[model samples]
Target: MEVSPIWSSIVTAAGGLLTGLAGTSGPLWHQRRALARARHAAEHDTTTGLPNRRALTAAVTRTVRRATPFGLVMLDLDGFKAINDTFGHEAGNDLLAEVGTRLAHLGPPVVMAARLSGDEFALLVAGGSDEIAAAAHAAWRAVSHPPVRLGEQAVPLRASVGHTTATLGISPRNLLHQADTAMYQAKQTGGGVHGATEPGPVTDPPPGTRRRDLRHPH
Candidate 1:
């Protein structure tokens, strides 16, 4: 009897289990499964389920090595501290998870999204200068939608977004730094979006400035 292609594939995948149930493939399968689980854990953020910082770096490095046209966007949530302070840390965590959901569905160009610690997030996309900016804007729009409900109150979401396009010689670190600087600029200019066209100083707002600015309802 000739084995069907489907059965053959299944047997091959199962390490010839059909040939012999007591074969020594259990150890190999266990090893492969363990390695896959470990890799997933290493690459994903525990809280938001987005890519972790190390994964982000590896992705950008691959893009740079391939000399691909890529875009990087850095986003920082506005009023995140106040939410934690008022509603508590649990609410803050919930908000971050929701934000991650929105970013992950940004569609097209955006190949990867990552939560880069705290209230900061990053996006890796493929596009030219204008297309990248559009993707960044779309991401910002998605995050800025709907109020994050906490108990009886509905708190409007807001974030500062900044983008940088990769050039032939630019390193991943430099690209991220540039996007971060532009995000800072956006926050300083009343929280919207900005893009880095050149290298320059990116200063943080005064300690109390964010609290004051974000205190009022949107």
Candidate 2:
């Protein structure tokens, strides 16, 4: 009957609408999840799961208040280019992940460990220079242990560290720059021991450095 056909068409239309709505919702849900993952990835290192430089800087700025003894450590993977050129970036990335794992085990005082970029990394420590030095030494020794498993081979990764710590007063950016300089000094010293400030030494702290107190926001 004509009436039956009309009813059938109406039912079919309703069904199609529901099906379309359901189908579209699934993809939308997936898309949202994917977007969240992408955002998370953007702020984190894929291999290490550690925060990148941008995130690290923000965290440092927020955490380094007037009362805390803050320190910064700059780390560079020694012989990283050799590994990447001789082996592959895959191997190099794996090595970085392994290093990150070791660093995480160091626990407190090391508030944050971030992969600045590439084979270079940095740590924000909630302590003075001495604490930073101890931690850097530990991290250095930790990385020097038996080679990591890479493509059926044991890949050795070593680190050179430099640290600048301020218990009373130092800006996070300046602390990092000084720490970077210190790490360079360590690299020049053949990558052993800890706490080398310009190795050849005898220069006084900059004119304004001695006057700054970390305990007060300058």
Candidate 3:
């Protein structure tokens, strides 16, 4: 996929600027939010029309600083490669676009949703443990319920979710990593949702599975 040079430049500049201003005071924080909103296009996925990885990181970082309680849910489709291999990449992409749309309208507690490359997506929400669990389950149902149609092909999609709740003093990277780890566990023990209550070693994706990229927006 040939990305627009304009899009690339905007993302680079905005992400670098935000990362550099990590510890700025008062007015600068407001400026950060303004910059993020103003340049939202730069940080959104062209295929899914959702925030990309960089946007999610910035939002999570800001929430951490405010000591806000939030939840992080990481989702990855199960057996996605088989679908692409059997049906085609176009069908896979269509299914993902539908999944993205469903994720975006989760409403209430879900404050942000983004595609984190490949078949992985993440959701950030304002909530406590119980609320976060409920929200994650709701999202899982949203993704897994309907059979996604790509032309004549009716594809049944299944996704695994890894979720965690954060308070204060936790870095955005740590929060994402913990959730990612739990997500791997979910995939390991038959796809469903897993909560990150205990830390463990990272698990590999299931055997015989090869990762591939499906999005190529020109």
Minimal lDDT window, size 10, model 2: 209-218
RMSD of 1: 8.1
Can you rank all candidates by lDDT, best first? Answer: 1, 3, 2
- Stretches of candidate 1 off by over 4 Å are 1-23, 200-218
Q: What TM-score would each prediction reach against the true structure?
A: 0.80, 0.71, 0.74
Which candidate has the highest lDDT of all?
A: 1
- Give the Å error, residue 171, model 3: 0.3
| Winner on lDDT (2 vs 3) | 3
Task: List per-prediction Cα lDDT, in the order shown.
Answer: 0.85, 0.75, 0.83
lDDT of 1 by residue, 120-165 (tens): 9999999898888998899889988788777788889999898989
- Tens-digit lDDT track of model 2 for 1-218: 35698899999999999999999999999999999998888788888999898888887777666567777777887888788888888777888898888877777788888888777778878777678888788778778897778888887778888777764556677767677667766766776544645435634445565211211125
lDDT of 2 at 78: 80
Clashes of each: 0, 5, 0
Q: How accurate is candidate 1 locally (lDDT)?
A: 0.85
